[model samples]
Target: MTKRSKAFNIKKGDTVKVIAGKDKGAEGKVISVLIDDQRVIVEGVNRVKKHEKVVNQGGGNTGGIVTTEAPIHVSNVMLVDGEGVTRVGFRREEATKTRADGSTYTVQRSVRVSRKTGKDI
Candidate 1:
């Protein structure tokens, strides 16, 4: 048995603030979301050093101690809404879609919303 990836409200480029972790209170844009791992990689957060072996191929990439951002658990960060941080909420709204044949249909689409301001995220 393995864990499955679920839909997460957080997305790449969303600004998030670390709530509980070594980087508490630190804020940065979300670089990527790892749904399966239930983790997120925030820009400028969770920095780690990785050592690599030099590969030899015509102009092979240089390998050494490299600093990179590591993934932090999603529970450790909160989305930043304007001046404050808030929880992510979902709102279903009817949206119109057009088919290739020019036929239009209405569908309910879930939109990421801010729990604090009741605004779309």
Candidate 2:
């Protein structure tokens, strides 16, 4: 049997803070998300040195001991809100809309909300 992983609420472009690991307390904007590995690469967090070979393709590409952000486990980070790090929650809301014939209908939408303040994120 196999288990499915839950979708991550943290997405690219969101500000997050590291809650655990060597980079604990570090805060940065989320640069990318690795859903399959359940890891997130936050800007300026979990940096590591990489050795690369210089390529003679187009413009000269210099490569040697380059420092870059490394992927951190998603669970070690928390989304940052107005009041600081807080857990994320989902809220479903109904919206009423009218069509060209003046007919009304309802649609449901889900939004990410802050658990601490219960406000939309």
Candidate with top lDDT is 2
Q: Judged by TM-score, which candidate is best?
A: 1
Any residue pairs clashing in model 2, and if so which?
none
Record all residue pairs in model 1 with backbone atoms less than 3 Å apart, i.e. clashing: none
Where does candidate 2 stray beyond 4 Å?
A: 1-3, 96-104
Question: What digit string (tens of lDDT, one per residue) describes model 2 on residues 1-121?
Answer: 5557779999999999999999999999999999888999999999999998998889676978899999999999999998589999999999999999999999999899999999899
- lDDT by residue for model 1 over 1-121, one digit each (tens)? 9976788878999999999979999999998888889999999999999998898989887999999999999989999999999999888899999999999999999899899999898
Error of 1 at 13 (Å): 1.0
TM-score to native of every candidate shown: 0.92, 0.87
Cα displacement (Å) at residue 75, model 2? 0.3
